[model samples]
Target chain A: MSIPNDRKYLSTHEWHKAEGNVVTIGITQFAADELTDVTYVQLPRVGATLQAGGSFGEIESVKTASDLNCGVSGTVVAVNEALTNDPGLVNRDPFGQGWMIKVQVSDLNELNALLAPADYLKNAGH
Target chain B: MLKHTPFYDFHVSADARMVDYSGWEMPLMYRSVVDEHQQTRNSGSIFDVSHMGRLHFSGSDTRRFLNLVLTRPVDDMVVGQSRYALVCNESGGVLDDIIVSRDNKHYLMVCNAGNREKLIQYFTAFRREHDLDFDLADQTESTGMVALQGPKVIERLASVLPVDVKSIKRYHFETAKIMLIKLSVFRSGYTGEDGIEIILPAMMAGMAMKMLAGKMDKENATLKPAGLAARDTLRLEAGMPLYGHELDENIDPISAGLKWAVNLDSNFVGVQKLREIAAQGPKRVLVGLELEDRRIARQGTTLATSDGAPVGQVTSGTFSPTLQKSIAMAFVDADHSAIGTQLSADLKGSPSQARIVKLPFYKRSNP
Candidate 1:
């Protein structure tokens, strides 16, 4: 699967898609494939403050658990409610329906530190 | 360096996500752990278990040596019968749990992969100390093993296998020749399902797998290749004890809820210590825990009372695919092991409500 060229990513595998002042956050396809069957996803609550490079929540697959990190400092405007019932979406369609959070960016410049799609795919050794 | 099983090439060809497990490069999952887990429960799945150690023993003193070392009495076992037994240290702490099968001229012992080398050393030392006359052969690398498990396993195997698998009573094994290769098929498995585990020559594993698992890659195939990840979940849900998690040098079979497998009447290496433990009762007992929420209580998580008093620690945990709930196995203070006892699992810093429940969280309706 080709990396979506529109989004920026953290080296840890979280992706950031900025639309105006809001940025949609989710794990990359590579991370999802690595995680296998995602059983549960604990996302930061709406209105919670997130710090760039800080852990916001956790994602659990059958084998193990890993922390989910944020790419930009912002207030969480929304969380994916669908994940509460079906966490496997992250394994099936990680970029689209599996989006975890929508953050209203406090500083748009933080996105510059994130990796571009090509860089992420290269660094992740995809 | 990690070791590879005979099925390593098959796993790679099937696109398995391989991982290092106990110094062995084994497939952790083929596609999805949950899907593989469900396949075992509902239909059937094949597991490459060649990484486990297989030891063969033969001699006039084979049974006597085994009786001296194993917790279970081996004198009365008929040929082709298997018994689950545990090896314990002098203080009754578990060394490893094994399945000892009595064959016509030898005994077969299947043990955990990680404990293979340790057990070999232990057995050799014990044999010399006791001046026992028996032959112990390490056949782990020279032989291959696989478990075909699920509700539909017996029916499916009935068609391909030459022996009458359905007639082979549970816990019994039969020797058969398939395509000129000799093999032993035991009606046994760790997945808490109706299944059989086959042991054959390592060189013939690929051909045997193809013969047994016909067109497994097909979309509607009943027996697909599963991995270590799904096997862990299935065994956990079945309330079986794992070596590193539930059984270790510090944990005894009495405390791990395997008292039935222990024979105090017969004098074994740890019989005296085990007798004391059985009479006085174990200080800690294994129990099943059902968490109120989806958050998993991982191994080493502290267990406490509602008012915040530490009770025990989790040994293994997972979000059970069959039950759709967070379940864990924990060793709690014997006083707090009763069913319906309320407890809390300290998942890192967060507290999750937990309750003691009956073991074997899931049992097949037909079983």
Candidate 2:
């Protein structure tokens, strides 16, 4: 229900926590809340290359399925493997244990175009 | 005009995601569709089944009348008991699939909401043809139906709801009062869980929904309020046939893999044609198909052979929450309906490999 302000947010509802070149990415709390109960998460695989704004994964609810867009371009270094067994973790704690993948940012400058917590919250429709 | 259920405003107040379903403005989900689906599998979920119509048949010749009309024997179905039955035309085509429950001197039939009018006229015409003394009434407008499903529903409902559901057998019902509101509770649901479908009057509909909420809070229980979205996916994964997709004027119950429902020894209206069809199998058959890829094959998509020859078409398709795979039901050539029969589904001109599986794509622990 609460969005953490320390991470970088994307217009596509993904959040990033950058540490040096490696950055952790996950869907925002707002996104998970909007989607309600997540049934399946097709997370990006380790060592997969991704382009910014390109779809890297998918998530399916009961009636519909949606693509998970890549907010930051880079090789997927690490992925949260826990999601396959317990996708509900993403809904329970999107920012904490629900982080999808870790990617080495192709360009750190892309974060500059992303939104701040206040601005992201505004765009998320509260 | 599409009629709104009594709980229509309550759905809006709860912030249910709304969509137009068969011309009626109904909630697709309260929070999330998959979440609600899991709640029914793991815990409990409530549903607004008001859109399903209920028709009452009563009179002295209701027995003789039903025998001449429906494919099932109502005279054999004892009072306070329910039987899944089907009504077919004289030509052996399925008119609709319904549940006929014997209620006192009258017979209560619950049918698809979309075909209520047509079914009524068909039944009425049969009554006139047979010169039977029975009355048919549409109780759907005055009745409200809610499905409380899952393993935990019994524990949660026992606390606040004023009903002794312990005696209500599966597919059977009994009348009880809840918070001074009368209710006809049935121990049957589509979710394949141990639950009850409470039939309350329109004025008391909100009371039932509130009663479930009241019990959830009082017992510190968790129950999801599911909408039609989860209902569709859950039923599809359970391999249950929807009327329009699996049963229609073009299809018969025997071909749709529903032979137990059609009683041949009893001699119904469609008996002559059905007897012939039973001896010789129908043209097409319903089969389950599992796709390996995440790309789903939706309804009406053309089915094809491994070599890309058009064979049949998918009736319903969705991503299964339990199996973590895309599954669908399709009517195909009877010869190709066997298990592991490799085929391809033409998804918008692109073919996707699919394997034929058993009827139900997902089966729960219980039988």
Candidate 3:
């Protein structure tokens, strides 16, 4: 799978896409593939505050569980509720319908610290 | 360096995700764990279990030696019978759980891969101390083992195997020849399903795999290649214990709920301690737990009462693909081990409601 050029990635494998004042956060395809079958996802509730480089929730696969991290500080405006019933969506389409949370970006400068698509692809050993 | 099984090339070519297990490079899963698990329950699946230890015991005093070491009585075991037994330390702590099979000329024992060297040393020391006469040979690397497990396994095997596999009763085995290679087929498995585990020479494993694969339809495989991940889940759903998780040198068969495999009347190494434990009752007992939600309560999770009193800790847990629920096995205080007892599992910081249930959460109706 190709890394979407429109987003910036964290070294921990979380992708952040900034659109106007909101940034949508999700795990990269490489991370999902490594987790095998995604059985459950726990996302931060709407209106919850999140800080950059802080854990926002959790993601669980059949074999293990991992923390879901955030790259941009903001208030969570929306969450992917569909994941509650269909966690496999993350395995099938990790970039689109698998987006975990949408945050009202508190600062645009935080995005500069994340890695570019090419850099992420290189660091991820693609 | 990790050891490679004879089926290593096949697993790689099949795109299996290989991992290091008990110092062996084995496949964790080929496609997905849940998919392989469902394939086993619905139809059939083949597993490469060559990493487990296979030991051959022979000599004039083999029977007497086994009777003194094994928790189960070996005198009554007729030829071609297999029994689940445990080797225990002097304090009654489980050293390892093994399957002892009575063959025509000798006895075969299969044990966990991680404990293979430890068990061999233990047995060797015992033989030296007691001046027992027997020959023990490590055949794990010289032989290969595979399990064909599922509801459809017997019918599929009956057509290809030279013998009547269906007629072989549970816990019994037969020796047969396939492609001029001698093979031992046992009507037994770790999964809670009807299946057979076969042992053959290492050099013939590839030919046997190809021959078995020819029987299945490629488009919709009847016997798909499963991995260690599915095998663990399948055994967990069946309420079977895994070494290092449920059984250890610090844990005993009495507390692990394996009393049936222990014959106290026999003068085994741990018979005296086990008898005392049986008379006084085990302080902690293994029990099954069903969580209220899908979040897995993994190993080492703390178990507590509704009032926040710590009761026990989880030994193994997974989101069951068959029952579609989160199930776990834990060793709680004997007073809290009864079915229907409500306990809470501390998942990280939050607590999840859990209820004690029967040991086996899933049972095949036809069997």
Better of 1 and 2 by lDDT: 1
After superposition on all CA atoms, what RMSD does each candidate show versus the true structure? Answer: 1.2, 4.1, 1.4
Better of 2 and 3 by TM-score: 3
Instruction: Candidate 2: give the clashing pairs.
Output: none
TM-score of chain B of 1: 0.99
Error of 1 at B124 (Å): 1.6
The TM-score of chain B in candidate 3 is: 0.98
Give the alpha carbon lDDT tens digit for every residue of B1-367 in model 3: 9999988888988889999999999999988898899999999999999999999999988999999889997999899999999999899999999999999888999999999999999889888998988999999999999999999999988888898999999999999998688989999999899999999999998888887656443747779899999999999999999998999998999999999999888999988999999999999999999999889999899999999999999999998998888899999999888899999999998999999999898899878
Q: Which scores better on DockQ, 2 or 3?
A: 3
Model 1 C-alpha lDDT per residue in residues B1-367, reported as the tens digit of each score: 9988889899999999899988889998897889899999999999999999999999888999999889998999999999999999899999999999999999999999999999999989888988999999999999999999999999999999999999999999999998788989999999999899999999999899999999999888999999999999999999999999999989989999999999999889888999999999999999999999888888999999888999999999999999999999999999989999999999878899999999999888876
What's the CA error at residue B276 for candidate 1, in Å? 1.2
**lDDT against the true structure, each candidate:** 0.93, 0.81, 0.92
Evaluate fnat for each of the predicted models and list the values in order. Answer: 0.69, 0.50, 0.88
Report fnat, model 3. 0.88
Give me the TM-scores for chain A across all models, comma-separated: 0.98, 0.92, 0.97
Taking chain A of model 1 alone, its TM-score versus the true chain A equals 0.98
Give per-residue lDDT, candidate 1, residue A117: 88
In model 2, the Cα lDDT at residue B146 comes to 87
Order of models, best TM-score first: 1, 3, 2
Which of candidates 1 and 2 is the stronger one according to DockQ?
1
> Residue by residue across A53-81, what tens digits does model 3's lDDT show?
99999999878999999889999999999
